[model samples]
Target: MTGVPASAAGGTGRTVPRGKLGTAAVNQASLWNIANILTMVRLVLVPAFVVLLLQDGGHDPVWRAWAWAAFAVAMITDVFDGHLARAYNLVTDFGKIADPIADKAIMAAGLICLSSLGDLPWWVTGVILFRELGITLMRFWVIRHGVIPASRGGKMKTLAQGTAVGMYVLVLTGPLATFRFWVMTVAVVLTVVTGLDYVRQAVVLRRRGLAAERADAAAKAGQRA
Candidate 1:
């Protein structure tokens, strides 16, 4: 309701319903917005977070706490940005492009730092990083086609990952250490499973997109002929 911009009819500059804006109009929307600002903040936090995370090899509890706080703040921006984008219909091309980059950067940096400190298994880091980067590439590959909203499994994987990373960053001991291991295991499993599913979905979408393009082309040829 509020904060909704007046929609145009397919870039015609004529007012129209927001939901009925044509593809060209939507694509022409401006890059700067509230959501994108949050995304940019996340990007700025990446190097700072990695620095804090790796300091003193993550052995100093005081510094580790600072790193955890930084990571938490970064993740919080992620949550709010997406929410604000969807709630206010403030989504834009720049937000779509920059948002995932920030997510992957922060998460990958954290995972790598943890592995470097010998806090987590390298194999786990390798697998999750592979999946994260692969899926991100897939998203860009299909950027001209359409977007894939995060699936339920992807959401679960994020929760598992965040929880596990928090545990590792906080350096919980004893019983909690065992619990974190199990949580991370779940995260890894979800990571792999959802990753494979994403690949399957991307393939299907690409095929459909190609088919539609071919059909559209043939239609134009027939009309011209």
Candidate 2:
């Protein structure tokens, strides 16, 4: 999942001055704000998408179209929720956590359903899911050290994956099917390459963070002595 945009204040939120008294009012964003609501909606769509995709034994073009619609809505929300959260300063803890989950949930559901239906290869799903989940865990592993900022290549990977999956969700044939194969190939390549880059960054960040901590502790001991 792409990183949510940083807030206007270079933080998650900000206080705005308001009213005739010109008092500062903290815009305490609630968990139920528009952005978070969109994320929750995407979560709900995951099951609905699966049902639509697998209906009629998972081969009906009309059913697949419906499933694609659900998938499209989920992706559209994925785009807007982050934008809305950043633009309106509606970022919240629930949003921060739920947004990425919503992104991966819908995409995973799409990929798995397609694979289960024998449309896409299971290995493709495995590679993409492994990279996405691994990077997520790696982020947490080094979170105390520092955030691994999203790179251009990482954004490209997300785009490639989304486009490839969306194409697979549709019941395309002939030339279109051939084209999507190549698209998915590109997506898989990006997934593996970017995942390796993230691992390298996590190692460097953790080492640096640990060294800084040690230096601080040594200085504190000297001060006490």
Candidate 3:
């Protein structure tokens, strides 16, 4: 089997197995990789998106369209960055932490801006943001145990939210407005349900992690005796 050459292993004059080296390389993926760059682009777009969104009293269709463009770019990048990271083994600690923060930042900015403009009710924003913030905290809470891979339900929730928020960002009227309201409703429901599911997963993960630590400790003690 192919292996990492000695020169690539700190010039130690010893080759390393390909499997182990590949795993280590992935774990140490550079911060400057395409995945992390896309994530940073999303982060940069948030402020620009907000500026476009709130421009001209937040009612002009033209400016709203621009804001929606920015938002769309941000959301599109969100999908690609994660896919690229996982597919190409470009996942890094920075990507793991920043991707979610960028996701929440863009969405939170859009929601707060819409609420402030009286376009969306504050209660809806409150509900979605609360769930988002709670889930994020829960991720950090169990982070020491392991990373939580995004579930199918979580992907659905994100799609629902992006669609709903995108619609709201536009100057829809009459029937379209009503449709958006329903979409937002679904998004909100998904948000709550997925949040609860994540909480359950976090609890289970922490429990297992703790149990494993205890088992390791016992094994070490037995070995010593």
The residue-level lDDT of candidate 2 at 57 comes to 97
Q: Write the per-residue lDDT of candidate 3 for residues 1-225, one digit (tens) a residue.
A: 577779988799998988898877766658789999999999999999999999999999999999999999999999999999889888888998899899999999999999999999999999999998988888889999998888999999999999999999999999999999999999999999998999999999999999999999999999999
Candidate 3 lDDT (Cα, 0 to 1)? 0.94
Better of 2 and 3 by lDDT: 3
Candidate that beats the other on TM-score, 1 or 2, i.e. the better one? 2
lDDT of 1 by residue, 52-111 (tens): 877876688878888888889888888999999999898887887799889888889889
Scanning candidate 1 in windows of ten residues, the lowest lDDT window is 1-10
* CA RMSD of each candidate after superposition: 6.9, 9.0, 4.6
Candidate 1, which segments miss by more than 4 Å at Cα?
A: 1-33
Q: Looking at candidate 2, what is the lDDT of residue 152?
A: 90
Model 1 residue 215 lDDT? 99
Q: Between the candidate structures 1 and 3, which one is better when assessed by TM-score? A: 3
| lDDT of candidate 2 over 1-225, digit per residue (tens) | 223234522465543323411222234436768998999999999999999999999999999999999988998898899999999888888888988899899889999999999998899899999999999999999999999998999888988888888899898999999999999999999999999999999999999999999999999999999
TM for candidate 3 is: 0.83
Worst 10 residues of 2 by lDDT: 16-25
The list of candidate 2 runs beyond 4 A from truth reads 1-29
| Global lDDT of each candidate | 0.85, 0.88, 0.94
* Residue 210, candidate 2: C-alpha displacement in angstroms: 0.4
Judging by lDDT, tell me the better candidate of 1 and 3: 3
